[model samples]
Target: MSDNPAADAVLNLVKQQHDVLEKMLNNVSQAGEAQRKAAMGSLERFLSAHEAAEEAYLEQATKNLENMQGWVEKLTELDYTSSDFVTRFGEFQKELINHTQTEIQHTIPKALRDMTQAQIDLVQSAFERVSETAEPVE
Candidate 1:
């Protein structure tokens, strides 16, 4: 799990979206026209919700990362060779790598394997809520 709760929630939601997409694809492959149409409709809703939620989540995460990187740049401007500066930079780098690995390898796969139905439903609800209020793109 990430230290960031928002990131964890977003990741779980993304995993759920992928699962829904896969199921919809299977329905497309094996179901009759009526069933396929129903599945496609569900897919459209899920995709709209997923995209809105992911955009909001990622926008925040990117802003946070940018702020951190700006701090790192400030540190470099101060004294890149100082022991304290080097140590802080190393810590930041390590944290960035760990965060990446955890999201890619652990959190995502674990969400798929371990999330309960209720948890999945909660994420879906969150997505729907976001989608409902999001402004339409021109």
Candidate 2:
């Protein structure tokens, strides 16, 4: 199956946001106390915006994935066989894996514990709606 343009757009946006966040984090680390605090304010806003956009786009892509069946099949269709593509993809994969591991180990659990049931329910509802729209694999 051909790649979905909408999904590609979302993925590109997410990558861009990730780059911005990484840069902001570097700035925070290098800054003085006052500068660090200012950088953190920007980081907070970027993080919140990134999270919301990711959730929305991922919700749609999740449904599309169900229709396409397993992700491996879709991934295989991409033209990542070129050396340049492979190198870049490998770097992205490493960064993504590290980021995901950190979130799973620390960020997600803390957020789950801190959030109210109502807040959790809202997130659950959003995800459920996406799942509901997904076409089951035959």
Candidate 3:
């Protein structure tokens, strides 16, 4: 598949957050109380930041598209505050992976093929901001 640098970057951003979430879950499972607490705190930040970026781009952009509004609704319905939030986050992350792949594979090329570099930069920078100082999982 031809690369859409902007979309690929967005996929990477979400993947990074998913990786962070996985690491947090694993750390919590293996660590003492303090460590688990710390890990969960970090996970919270990663999850929140990633969600923000995703909403700003993927969700917002796709909301008006046919067959994609469902995803928007799903995103809203997901409960990020449940006790099972970690595992649920994993599920949500997988959904996002699917969404990213769809965007890169089909949607991005179709929707953003003619978009300007400035638009791409705006999206990229939005994702990158979440990389820095996104609150800890707490």
Total clashing pairs for each candidate: 0, 0, 6
Candidate 1 per-residue lDDT, tens place, 38-72, comes to 44445445545554453443443343344444644
Candidate 2 wrongly placed segments (more than 4 Å):
56-97, 100-138
TM-score of each: 0.39, 0.42, 0.53
What is candidate 1's local distance difference test score? 0.49
- Residue range 1-138, candidate 2, lDDT tens digits: 114333333333344445565666566445554564555456545544444533553343233323222322333344434444344434534554466445434444444455555654554454344334322211
Measured over all alpha carbons after superposition, the RMSD of each candidate to the real structure, in angstroms, is 17.1, 17.6, 6.3
C-alpha RMSD (angstroms) for model 3? 6.3
Ranking of models by lDDT: 3, 1, 2
Deviation from native of the Cα of residue 32 in model 2, angstroms: 1.1
Clashing pairs in 3: 41-136, 41-137, 41-138, 42-137, 44-137, 45-137
TM-score of 3: 0.53
Q: Which parts of model 3 are misplaced by more than 4 Å?
A: 60-116, 134-138
Which rank order by TM-score, best down to worst? Answer: 3, 2, 1
Clashing pairs in model 1, backbone N/Cα/C closer than 3 A:
none
Total clashing pairs in model 3: 6
| Least well predicted 10-residue stretch by lDDT in candidate 2 | 64-73
